[model samples]
Target: MAEDRKAIVPVWTLATGDVRAPALAGGEPMTAERLAELRGVLAVMADVPIATLEAHPLPDKLDRSRGIPLDAASPLAQHLSQFITQSTRSSLTAARATAMGENLYRMVVPAKVAAQFDKGFICSMAAKGTVGGIRGPLVTSTGRIAAGATFVPVGKAAAAGAAGGAGATAGVAAAGSAALTVAAPLVLMAVAVGVSAHADNKRQQAIEHITELLEQLHEQKLEEEHSALDGCRDAIDKATAILLDQGKLGVSLGLDSAVHAINTALGAADRRLARWQTALDKLPDDKPVEIGTLTKSFPGVDEHGGTFRAHLELAALAIALKRRVVVLQAVDHAQSDPGNPFENFTRALRRDQQRLDELESGIAGVLVRLSALELARQDGLMPVFTAGEVDRLMRAAHRIRRLGDGVTVNGRTTDVAIEIARNKDGSVVVFPALPMGA
Candidate 1:
């Protein structure tokens, strides 16, 4: 676990005093490309006036509170402290982004999908006349059956022989044929009921699977992340305390030691937040959906539910990416620097915002697909989803879309994200993003 935390941070980390929490930690350091960016931060810091806030009035973006670096410092110590400050913003964003998907899929999608299944199965029976198709035209598609649509007699193909034999002349033969004709529709209905039952069972299993996934994400990964983040803070606090107490003389004396301890702290924090790593990564992200939650214990969901898995993966990734931007935005907001100190940060934000635009497009497309989905087309026996079913699915996707937005107090940045938590209902909707220490 300790080693896991060390690998996520790039050795060289800084971004014009606008460093994002996740950006400081990732799969690998962009040291080669970001050298110039680091130098730029140093230049900007000189010109910008900075302030320290041990606690902010606003909700901490990742829900981790930061310990301020000593206000007065050596230039080297001062510059390095920026890394500590960003690291202080923790893994709550990752946890929240992850929970948004798991909970939405668990609590929302399965129930809605199952309800559609029940309605479609009923429609199928009516269309087959096991229940009466002629009671009223059993229209599977929207409105009533289209004007010239071809009609197949509900159970005609399957029951043809039995119905035809009813005209037999011999007394015994006629009696038997009449009985077969009477029993045919009943037999067919029994079969459809069995198939529908089997499908419903799978849906139930999927809901259970999703529930377990949500539980593990909170109980395991979230817990581990908080513990690891605390480790990072402890390392930084020890080193910074020395720098704070000794002041200029300490930098002149034990400067190298302080720098080394700070570096150790940064490395740990980075690894702790590498949500994308498959093996030892403590944080949460989309890659795990393929490897774990989305695929696990969902029966045919992974195999037959291609569209289901795809939308979920996209939703989870998109929301996490948005949270990443919000964390960066929060960091940028934290710096009390005058004028614009972060052209690079703003450019990064713009790039992420554009990617989100692409993701949301994908999200919207699937929503349409879900809204129009016809189990009748997919399974032949079930009918088209009812309007209510479509609405339910659409509502789930829309809520997931909101998580991608994150909370934006400023009206101007509306285009930047989906609306995450609204004013008071946030706690009810958003799962706890971090534990106490993180």
Candidate 2:
């Protein structure tokens, strides 16, 4: 996996009353004492090798004669044009004209340098601005900016075979086959008991009961299809052979067209089987019925009977019924609802919805904070830096070997040993060396 690279731009603020003079208690020039304090702060900044990018007012189309400075005397002023050009190249051209009245300036520093400046310089100056002490001429603040990417890995061609229309059709066909395989024998057993009748309510009840049982069996088989789809197909072929053998046996016993009855039952089972298979297919994999409950639901048979031929016929039918029922019961237990599937699904959906809502709210808050920061910059209460300028400075510092391996920022030590590499398949991976101590 390729680790996402986030562009981190360090931002600082300086309060200047030039743009919004009325916002100040009184519109005043730099006092002698205040100017001395500001000079001291600037002297400390000059010692630091960090490049500063100052935002300047540009002439609009109405005032085209007022051109920007071609060269700067100060080191901070020297980087202004370069920063603007870099920002424009990096698709931040709109930022140049977005804010008109700000006298804000930005500095691009390596994380290590920023950390040192904040701790060794800014804190000392801020501490001097106490109630009983002399107030510092400059008002300063600092922040950082970051972004991330998410990647989803794609599987191989073999995995792709389990998706798309062809896979779906094959799944339906297999389910139908499993349903009919288990259903055919059970239906025959019901018909052998002469439960298929017209007008007799008891016979109708028996037929309905058999149909329900077959449906339940079909569902179980379909669930097993996830793991034993091929096995179910094999079982279907064997069951078909057994049905044929039973029909021949029925003929020898003088039963009238038992083969025809078996075929008729298979046809009827196919019709209802498809519907049950479809229903089972829609069910999620996680919801499975209890095996114990399914086992208890299956009908058991006694071997006691009349004449040898009659007893054999009855026993054969009973055996077929029990076999199909056991298979069906297993299928049901493996696939059917262990608990309320719908309720579980609904609860999961609600939780996901709530999570999405929370994420949306969090993102909105970040955006609002960013907007407020921008407004502060425009009002000359904050300083701004382009991400490109920050990246360029970091790269240059890295080349010169001026930056350190670690630095303390806001009372926390942040290591710079994180390495990012890209794979041949285009995925990015990140490997961060552990810091000293556990």
Candidate 3:
């Protein structure tokens, strides 16, 4: 019993700044002081609201199960590790730039100024400038995680077939398809002549239903985008009406004030949306749909109660909303402007610009949250390779590191990379990259 107790491992470890809280700390376990310290750091960094919390003591060595880096076997690492590595590389490059800047300063500056200068100070500033220039969009691109393939479980496909048959009879989302299953195989065997007919009908029905839903989603996105555009236009129009009415009322009423800048911004919004609408109109309505093919391949085979499409549709809709939001921003600027028309509209333009800036700040947060949501759906869709398979790939690739040798799997050029490296805690992790085309 004592041996077993001593051998027990923790399930996980949470890192907070410099401190780590293991699930188990010896046999004594984690203390309050350590937890409090972790919570304090997290509170400051994340700005999380917490109840009155206390501090905790730290643990020395953490258990293997409760290690610093969790989920060493995650598929996310398999598909996204390279992107993370790329991001890390970008950071390193920026750091190098900073280091280089200080070197340049030392090279250029006089000795008297140089003697007083901090080590690597000039290099650091130059590196910062270089890094800052490439930071934002580069980071975002590096963080762009995507799933390369989709898989459906056998049981789910069967269930979908059964449910689809039942739904035809019952007209309900969760209806059972026992009747169809019972009749389907038997009906085909009884008459070979009707087999092709039955299969064709089934295939057509499946395709129709899938395509119909796809069209519906597309239309919904369009409507939402249009609604945002319309709202922006309405706001601008109202502000314009106010300005014109006041202009008639005279300069004393300040009606014509802030009018031109507001109108100019409104005009920009209208033009942008008009261009978007025209582009959308050009896309053929009969174009092939994505989810439809997935559905057609396995009719009525929706996992998570069709939640997958719902999530994807929401992402599409959100992007569309954001596109329209650019126009909405112009509307906001015009409506919120407070400058007089005769004064060259500086104050109003500045105020509108500030509002635009605030809108941009909020947009990034919204996009990140939306992306996270989209990524969360991946767990349900992607197949996870076995640990042995991951290990084999990683070890095989490790021998060829920095060799620039092309890796081919099953004779196809593979863009994916296998990372076999020690993590912070000295444990080996296998990080796989998305397929090359991916």
Task: Sum up the clashes in candidate 3.
Answer: 19
Residue 152 of model 3: what lDDT? 11
TM-score of 2: 0.16
Error of 2 at 202 (Å): 99
Clashes of each: 4, 9, 19
- Per-residue CA lDDT of model 2 for 133-180, tens digit only, reads 311111121111112211111101011011111111111112211110
Which candidate comes out best when scored by lDDT? Answer: 1
lDDT of 1 at 86: 33
- TM-score, predicted candidate 1 vs. hidden true structure: 0.22
**TM-scores of all candidate predictions against the true structure:** 0.22, 0.16, 0.18
| CA lDDT, every model vs. true structure | 0.25, 0.23, 0.24
After superposition, which runs of candidate 3 have C-alpha atoms over 4 Å from their true positions?
Answer: 1-225, 228-344, 365-438
Compared with the true structure, the alpha-carbon lDDT of candidate 3 equals: 0.24
Q: Model 1: runs farther than 4 Å from truth?
A: 1-318, 325-339, 342-344, 373-438
Q: Is candidate 2 or candidate 3 better by lDDT?
A: 3
